[model samples]
Target: MDKQPLLRNLETNQPCQPLSPQLLSMAATAAYPGAPQAEELASAPPAHLFDNVTGYEGTTAGGEERFVPPPLSTAEGAGRHEPHPQGAWSIPSITEETAREAFIEYASSKCCYSAKPAKEMVFRDLKSCNTYRYRLESFTESRSTEWTSEPYKGQFVDSSAYGPAPLPWSIIVEIPQLFQDNIEKVPVPHTSSIKGCHSCMAMGRRACTNCTATGRVKCQFCNGRGYKFDDRCNRCHGIGLQCCIQCNGSGTIPCETCDQSGQLMIYIQLTVKWKNNVLESVADQQSGLSADLYEKMIGQNIFTDEQVRVSPIVTFPEIQINQASRKAIQEHQVQLTRTSLVIQQRQTIEFIPITQVYYEWKGKEYNYFVCGVDNKVHAPDYPAKCCCTILCAVPGDLPMASGGQTVPPANMLDKLAGYESIAADGEERYLPPPVYPAYNAEGGQPQSNQQWSIPSISEDTARQALIQYASEHVTYSSRPAEEMVFKELKPYNMYRYRLQSFTESRSPEWKSEPYVGQVIDSSGFGIPPPPWEVPVDIPKMFEKNKKKVQVPNTASVKGCHKCMAMGKIPCNDCLQTGRVKCRMCDGRGSMLGNDTRCNHCMGNGVESCRSCSGHGQQKCDVCQGRGQLYFYIQLTVKWENNKFEQVIEQQCEFPTQKLSKVTGKELFSDQQFQVYPILGFPDPRINQISQQGIQEHWTQFGKTSRIIQQRHTVEIIPVTEVQFQWKNKEHSYFVYGTENKVYAPEYPGKKCMIL
Candidate 1:
């Protein structure tokens, strides 16, 4: 039975296509030795699954028009002799002076390192190794398929209404342009059908696995005991049982397979993905430098070629370059062609120069490498490290005495005597002498004449604020504000500007559900209007809203898949038995170890299933007991108002976030479809912010979402810093915004205990 053709050409009555190379190889390996039979090749999966169609058009099994990708073209002048241009192949080395400066800068950047080595080291030798890098990029497209289903709403069944279903590989789908990374999913034409939901076996609900169809479980809170610690259990009210939460005491849950519609719309989904694959190979330089370092360096591009399929270079001076090119091309084709179709191929060769400088310092040899067009240096080891201590002395200090005997000050003599004794006795008794600057008796005074436009609150209002703050924090006391002194208040004004861009965007998707009673819109049957072209009422600007509208003419009705047109299905809870074990007695016909008859079951071992009410069947939920569904495409329109704000930095020590919470005085306001930046504002920073906000909003959201309206406003938030003296100590508090909110980080009353 397996050795038979799954499909045949309608005209010739022969096999539709030949077996793939992979399938043929598998058959060759599985065939018996000396056997001449061709049955093994025919036993493989259908040829369409792996067909390599090399055409732009084809016909589906149902004679419907389909799209087929064309084969890749060969690169022009491939595998031909290409002469190198004069002076383009030369590798230049950097001068010694340039190498020294780069090394000196490198040494100076390290901590506790001296530049003596860089200055004194003599150049011994310099080696230059030029390496070549080969890179290949293949842009390809691949396809995959999967079976998906939705609730069987009254949707048009394409296969039932049209002709036979098309093969998966033969379905027509519009492919996006090649060499770009993209993903698309297309439904196979004439493949959609209605089928019974296999999940619940056409049942609208499934047995509650949590309670095992008993509708009740042992009470978790009371541990199945009627009483708890000599008292009746409150959770179960002495019944020692609780209704199943999953089934809501019905012993069954709505079937998820059919979405409670009791049917599904089954179809094959084809996913086409376009991807760019990159592969690189570098020629072995043997320069003792890491290949990864050369990769970061930009090399001279001696050769570049791009085409549908690139051939390996055969006439290059470097044998390694020719070999690497051949290997890369073969590997790319072998790896990508098995699962995907190559649309284009690009290959290039780069020649990077590397210089290794050998130098001598302090009778030892040291080496450093310079790489790339930017002359990046890599030096891990450098000689001449210093750990010298710096000392600061007062002016006009005593000079060193004759014979290197230094004359110390009287205070220094005491510190030195203790230092020597501690060192001789290994004791930590010595202390470093402290250096102090000459103290000035006169100190700066606080500014007293500054006045605030926004005055401080009255004593009564401050008291109420203290009480309100105390009520929120259990540990805080309200007694401090009553006695604290009022000090000077200075206001610092902060400016803020906010810009809002309100945009509306629409996205469309296919949706289906069990067909109930719904108005059918056949006007939108053909190609629906583009999202931007569709006319929709724009709501008030800056207010977010979302609405879904069905596309006209896209709706169709199909039979229910889950219940198979049967309005009802067997109840999963009872499994068509219409009965379940009694929960009170655990199917023992009695309670308390079979000593007493169970009151709930009247001595019966089983009770009727609550899910179907003893009928042993349930109404299909997917089709809503109608066993049909309606399918259509829907457009979701979403409105979003994006907000951008900028606040000028204030010189004072006020928190910027605090200003945002309070109301401010609006200085300037503008609203339009596309508002221009403010030209003449009192604060130059506000004008700059306005321009930046508008430009940034347009760049970030203009492409993906449609802009409906733009509005910008500037506000001045007044902030005051108040300084007061309390118990000979200075304290400060801030008052900001039009609301007069206070920010007192160091309130003097907070440090005092009221108790």
Candidate 2:
């Protein structure tokens, strides 16, 4: 896989020779079969999984390049390949044997250490001292230079940030005004115009059909003769017929119960209106942003009406309850009970606001990150200077030079790489030493002494993940925390980790489970600790004390007894006697039948509260019938973590930068990933304190890299010494190039070397 994108490089700006297959040759025809030869080059190691990417781990004695390509006379007017900074050093094609011979000849005929080759040796031990570094810088102002930031959008319902909130509903608001307003908005026929139409006693008819105009009808019992034989029709009293029962013997019966038209009037009270439910979003009115749906309008009245049903028209997800919300429903006075001003069909909106800041100072550029929500800097307290922090220096297996007196066991070559050459007593000196000089890149500017970087994850976010991991891993606790968020509980969570071991053999044996331990959180327990035990009972006493807080109870009801838990899943049918008016007669006592009160509901028209069985409430079950419970508690359990879920390693390829104008001393710090054993190590204290195998990761990318000017040395051949044996005689000569005076080739080197 191409890891360039994944691999974060230090970008120390060291120039390297490109790998090429250019063969070099130096041989004098068969005349001098002396097998004379020259030229060999050492190539740099390929990119590999080295402990450090910068490769600035060890202090090397050969601090600077020892080769210088003689200035080219390109314009003898002829085009020529640009001279490699160290090209000429491979000159005359000096072979390894020739170099070896030259070295032996130089050592034997010259001074100092012996030239004899080191004794053949085989070393078995391989060690690596890898140091981790972090870069942190602070600025007064800044803007993103080259970054691909992501804006995460979220949505939540909060009481409106502006205007009023919905709450404190009244249970008994006057209905006269509302009644009048509703009448005007939606008018009905006037009661005075609803005159009744009366008719003849015969069912609204103008005349009785049985009697016609006479309004009297012949008695059916006596026929037309008014006689029934023996008793003279005792029906008609002998001579005539009985008066007409239909018209009561009158010519025209009057129906005074109603007008001849028989029209009747009706009345009703309008229960619902537009103001009954209002849904306002940011677009409609200034509001706040939230991650989850929660009650936003606080201290506002929840208008209710007797005529209207009890259920709210709108609802919000119950996540967490703010303290102010609880108090608002409890302490705030009810504004109206006539009708509930329900929130319905809310129009939610969300946006992730990115604060892009820019600034400039002195002649340099940088940025100041003022974070959102948390109001913190992305990288706070970062240093404002270039850093060449030494990760960790380790001397690998290096060859030891034979000390005519005593041979050193260490690899002289490898050891020499981390330090400048120091002259030995008499015959001692740093090995491979051209003895290059150290150049201060940022002159007059203080070099960064510490190593730190931004974390791949924010401390707050990481803390939450760690706490969750620890909760699963630890074997001891009254109740290990779960689904925990930062600052939700009092105090903090800290733990001592143990590396578990399980036997794997013919008979696999169980080894460890979650360890058992008690959380020393004074506030986590339901019972309060004694005054003297306050400090000791708290976990991370010093650190958490500052952030210690009281979390509101999100588990149960608070505020209005009628609504129960604010507007959050509060009880709609709070009364065990949950009841409503009978639907018949429109809750009116009277019905069309017999124009009398309804017998089913005993004329009340309101049935027994079905929800409450006519009672106001059932047992207070959520609160255990107590109506209250502790606000918070730490869940106790034994941590059963058998293995680590995961370990992350992240790096950035480029350093972030920006332009700024504010001034302040930047802060820098590093997060140490040192593990300390509490029950497993021999010396618990020592094992915990010693950072031997710490796997520290510089996860965060620098917000801004400190720009520094480093001093470098370039190679040049002012004069080259050429020696050879010709015609049985040894002779030396010199080749002087172009005065080679103060040449400038935009060379990779910073200083000029006289070769």
The lDDT values for all models are 0.63, 0.25
Lowest lDDT block of 10, candidate 2? 139-148
Give the lowest summed-lDDT range of ten residues in model 1: 417-426
Q: Write the per-residue lDDT of candidate 2 for residues 1-755, one digit (tens) a residue.
A: 22121112458534322222231112111322332222111111111211221212221211121111112222234432321112111101222233334334433543333433211111111111111111111111101111011111221212123323211121122333322223111111111112222122113333333454354445455554445654556655654445655566664444333333333221111122323222222211111223222222121111221211122212211111122222223221133222223122111112212122232232122332222222222322222323343555333212312211121212221112122232212222212212223322222322222333311223344333333433321121212112222222121111112121111101101111111232223322444322112232223211212112222111121222212322222223532335667767668877754455564675777777565466554443333344222222111111111111111111321111210111112221112112222223322342332221111110110111111111111111122222333334443322222221111112111121212
Clashes of each: 31, 96
Which runs in model 2 stand beyond 4 Å of their true positions? 1-580, 592-604, 621-755
Q: Write the per-residue lDDT of candidate 1 for residues 1-755, one digit (tens) a residue.
A: 12333346889987544234355334434543433333222322222322222221132322122333333435433463442322334455687897888788878887778888888987755666657788888898776655456678788766535655565546666667655789888876766777655444456665565675668767766766656777777877877777766677887778766777867676655677789888888876677777677668877776778777777877665677779888988998788876777878878887776778887775356788877666777776766776655666644233422211122112211112112221211111212212222222222311212222433445455445545544433223555555556676566778788888898766655455777788755434455444455567888779889887865555666665556667676676777788988998889887764355576786788998998899977887766788666755565778888888767877888657555557777766777677777765666787677778777877776656777788888777877776656566777767666666667655554321112
